[model samples]
Target: MFPLEHIAIRQAAYYHPEKVVHNDYYLDHFKSRGKDIARFLQVMGREQRYIAAEGENALTMGYQAARKVLSDAGLASEDLDMIVFSSQTPEYTYPTNALLLHHRLRGKSRTITLDSNANCAGMVAAVEQASRYMQSNPHVRYALVVGSDLSSVNCNPEDEITLPNFGDAAAAVILERRAERPGFIDSLYYTDSDDCENIMFPACGLSNIYNPEMTPEQIRISWKPFDGTCVVEPAAADIEEVMRRNGLTLDDIAAFCLSQFSLKNIELICEKLGADMDKFIYVGDEFGYTGTSSPFIALQRGIEQGSIKRGDYIFFWSVGAGWQLPTVLFQY
Candidate 1:
């Protein structure tokens, strides 16, 4: 067997639509129905969210994030050896969104491009895969991984469960090979699909998506409340197992960049793990639940807030629909 090189995240940047939708935007609607959303909003740690307005979709938002990352990293699009795009609400189906991004960036012919849809766990999975690819292929040096979604537009406006929490956004990360150790470490994945139908997009299914008889109401994101506590115990256990396998304690980890879906969930995970709340970086209050981009968005904010620094060990994880869990340990 050959020795593997280190691959780590280098630069990060995120993007959201210009239209800012505050909590008050939905307050009147819920009020009209004799329901107060103030407590709900506070419980979910949602103060405001960015909604994708006209002319904004997953592709453009993702492109904006990717371009910013490339520029900040002092690298050009042609310098990239691979491009992985993750989005559930992608604007294209056959022509993978990654290919579209490559074309927009005018990438070279040898660049690798593909799309992945793992629900909210998309980016975390994408980063891990891209790192492994770079480590395996010596010619592949720089890779751009992006995760973006149109959460707001997909959520049914009347459903408070989805409408109030989701925000539309995109985040891009730069991964480069380094001659060092502990750059890309181990990952643990767990799936419990008993409640697979709790949340779904295009409820009518793809086969009926283009049927002329199908109405618009049958082809949008739907949300139904499930066991929210199902995330805490397992999430904490997974992170602990990953750290345990790597001989790391809570004190050894510099920061824990968890999903931005719910502050309560992050709190619960921290409490279960006996981890300090300060070590857990959260931006869900400001960014809302950005689906695929939530974890990376939290990571970028951690970098900006000085909560995480270079050469530090950071643990990343996310919870996707169908209760998918993916945890990754990396040196940033």
Candidate 2:
């Protein structure tokens, strides 16, 4: 066989603010609104989540995580050939969050930097995009992909869907090209935007950000509840397809790093796929739904906990808002 370019994960780390918000914290508040906070927590399988402290946001969280990953890998800013920041809760709309991060890291002038927002599935998309970009450019070797979100700040205070469920966290991964065995294999994507309007940040739209009449409530996240089950079938299909096309089987995968959106959904997908729950890595209960960083957080924690190891096959899957699914089949 002819030789081919390859890219694979080098290291990954995640960061969360110091504060922890448990289900009990939302009990009285959500109960007063006639909502079943207990059932909600039980159904979601969430115990507690990390919340940004007084001075934290996406940028800060992401930077900390990135620094940790780089430190662990013994890589300096100049070592990276590209930097990609993925988030919907970006700290700045202009100047590009990725570029800002690059500036903070004192990245080399030759490094390519950019920001992307594909909602929750962002990091998955970013990694795939970065891998493809690096594969085509022989000059680019190491790349940084960070996914962070301060969703708690964007959430509506009175909204049960956003306020009580969402949390803040950031995850960073270092990808490097290899010449040997397996690395990034192939990716599959499918989109279903029928419920596109259900979840939205900047409810009033960016154009109205400066409008004098726009109230605080209007600028916060707008979360209209929908059947989250929309993700299950598609997720299962995509996972199977990626494995099929790659000539891999369920037995070949060492772990499944799925979106931390809902534990119930993950359980259902496992049931549908007849896959063992032991192979699935989930950290949503403690971290909550961290938007774009969800899967990466799962990946990092999985590795740290010894659920995955070097040269093992890994499957990654996540769903974005307006609903986009990006599935990746990789060898760690």
Which number leads on TM-score? Answer: 2
Residue-wise C-alpha lDDT for candidate 1, range 1-332, written one tens digit per residue:
22448997889999988888889988888888777888878878899888888989999999999999999999999889899999989999979999999999999998999999999988998898888778778888788999999877777767777888889999999998877765889899989989899888888888888999887767877677776878899899999999999898999899988888888888899999998999998888888889899888888999999888888899889988898899999989
lDDT of 1: 0.88
- The regions of model 2 sitting more than 4 angstroms off are 1-4
Residue 304 accuracy (lDDT) in model 2: 86
Q: Which candidate is the best by lDDT?
A: 2
Extract clashing residue pairs from model 1: none
TM-score, predicted candidate 2 vs. hidden true structure: 0.97
Model 2 / residue 63 / CA error / Å: 0.6
**lDDT (CA) for every model shown?**
0.88, 0.89
Span of ten consecutive residues with least summed lDDT in model 2: 1-10
TM-score of each predicted structure versus truth: 0.96, 0.97
Candidate 2 residue pairs that clash: none
